[model samples]
Target: MNVELRYLRALVAVVDAETFTDAAIELGTSQAAVSRSIAALEQALGLRILQRTTRSFTPTPVGERIIAHARRVLDELALLERVAGDHGSELRVGYAWSALGRRTIALQRQWEELHPDVSLVWVQSNAPSGGLADGSADVAVRRRPLTEGRFTSTPIGAEARFAALAASDTLARRRVLRMADFAGRTIAVDRRTGTTSEELWPEESRPAGFRPVQGVDEWLTLISTGQALGMSSEATAAQNPRPGVAYRPVRDAPPIEVFLACWRDDPSPLVADFIRLARAAYLPG
Candidate 1:
């Protein structure tokens, strides 16, 4: 079975991205081109590698087997290229806005100290939408897991949601907060793009009268100025606990789990090292 490297690479991109459009964007190609590559690869292999539905692409048993081998082959190829060039160049790292916490910063510093040869370039993003797709980032720190199975994820830590309120707000005096405490009160939140906040929130644990704002900064600003109460991660509150704002733990709320995700099909040693450091720094002993 003669499979071109391009086809294998495309398959890996699609699997990592979970969608044809995302895969195409990551590969700097068109969706039609990505689809054609996958089709040709499947035809040559005489076996279906992916189970495609309207929502996402799932790897078939054979494809899963192929992916393991493909990752090893791709990694070896990347190592050869690195050896041929400068092996001690810059290592680009990406993180979502919510990941700028003490733990993340400490980990980065530790990694840099351990590998002084590697220069670390940090990129901050609100979401992973184009970070990996553009090839600008080698590793990504996200609050949610990569469900598409195209990225290998390592569970790092968990963050509980807290109700952040201005010091003048009546809720600020409360020792503990509940969903009913937010009833009829203006609550700020990060607006959803494709996915709804309802999906992210637990069905029974959602706060009544909760409303989303345009962005995280806006939400923080509103809460800090006494205009509204907002929801924020414990990590966020810990990092930016303003004098006017107080963080009270939310009772009966869902916590978001943090993960270190890397392109499963891409073989980059820097990404692997970052993932290792993240696990060591954040994962509970």
Candidate 2:
């Protein structure tokens, strides 16, 4: 109930090094401190984490699981530190897939011209939060609405949907496509970060099956193999052009709404300016 990161670190260090003396050395602390930390951890958890002998020690069954969780916690902490450390002179913007399509370069150039002292960095992440929740970015451009109350989002613009298909597929010959056209074919979908879903089509005309994928490259690869088809915003079509894949406008599918998001409690000072630029980029010129 009252576990601390230091105690968990000591337990892991002792288990990995096989001795309190080695763990202390690895942790850059005294052996007595390491031993006490482990004991405190065990007391707090009400469980013995290690099986120790006179010469060696190993993690108990439950200790292995706890240690794994501790490693993940530590890893996340390290990531947070790295992201926070770089916040001094950089404005990191995150996106799930394709950024702003043809407008990405224009936005970057404009930002550089306006604020030469601050570097405008774009980070592409596959998570639904687009790296905002993980502290990898100060702001995020997302195609879907985030329901969490800890974040605030505003609609920037919308992008038309496009169908991705293999070059050799019969549908590729069409100048445009419709949601119902691929009702009997399998579809590749990235459930976490993608804009495509069965809900895009009428229930009666849904795809025959859905193949799961993690990122844009994987979705494109699956489609290029002629194994499945995919649907995404026009931005993806413009940014990622695979030789074996063809993108056709999906005339009937609803356009995907785009939103700019940031932490509700600690938004970046540059978020307003970034949002303004993004809205301008998405506007019809």
Candidate 3:
């Protein structure tokens, strides 16, 4: 097939993003353009690449094979570009729980002022590295430090931890809390992206148990219904804002560290700029 790299990129973006519209958002193009790119690609190969249903979309048997190869090709291209010291016009900022939360808007505005030629795209993933390890993001912002030798990073800011409770809960009226206050509570925590852990408590006084939630929305839903309480970074409160949930400062809880990380071997010039911007944006007055 005479497929071009851009066409393959669009195809993979669609599948990874899970919709034509979302793929377009990531690719910085119109949904119609992304749809046309897929259609043209299928025509070139004489095979359908996607199977669409009313509620969702997925790759077909043939499409899955194509997608796998496309991803590999794109990854190689990215590596090549990185090695060549190319900071492309677009940068994808990946995150899990929250992408700088209340700082997001100011950061974006300042980023535009600092680098008007480059476009920034925020991509959310619940992966351990916020999709950086899987090549879905060029760089990532996460609360966890990058421990692997392959990655290098700097701390941008630290967010104060908060205790999330149902609005009707007795604790909701309190302005602040301590680790000891959560002794008998069953707390909901996201296994993948969350920074909170039962370890915050002493062995004997840890929360009654943990309710493992895979995503922030699920954590909020569980907390809202009083099935579980949650302790999380202040960013979670600023970003999610569920009606039934209230976030109070955890006076004695440890703060969550935030970092901007990228592959140490890649040498992407944009990573430095991102790290710098994040630091400046998050610095307290």
Task: Identify the candidate with maximal TM-score.
Answer: 2
Q: State the TM-score for model 2.
A: 0.73
lDDT of 1 at 49: 88
TM-score of 1: 0.62
Ten-residue segment with the worst summed lDDT in candidate 2?
78-87
The segments of candidate 3 whose C-alpha lies over 4 angstroms from its true place after superposition are 1-78, 81-87
- Point out where model 2 deviates above 4 Å: 1-87
Lowest summed lDDT window (length 10), candidate 1: 191-200
**Candidate 3 lDDT for residue 22:** 62
Task: Give a tens-digit lDDT track for model 1, residues 90-118.
Answer: 77666545554668578768877988888
Give a tens-digit lDDT track for model 2, residues 1-285. Answer: 789888877776676556786566446588999888988988999998888888777888998998889866855674565447446678889897888887899999999987788898999876556766556677888999877676788899999999999999999999999888989999999876789887777888888999988789899999999999999999999999999999999999899999988767554557778888899888887
* lDDT for each candidate structure: 0.69, 0.83, 0.82
- Clashes in each model (backbone N, CA, C under 3 Å)? 1, 0, 0
* TM-score of every prediction relative to native: 0.62, 0.73, 0.71
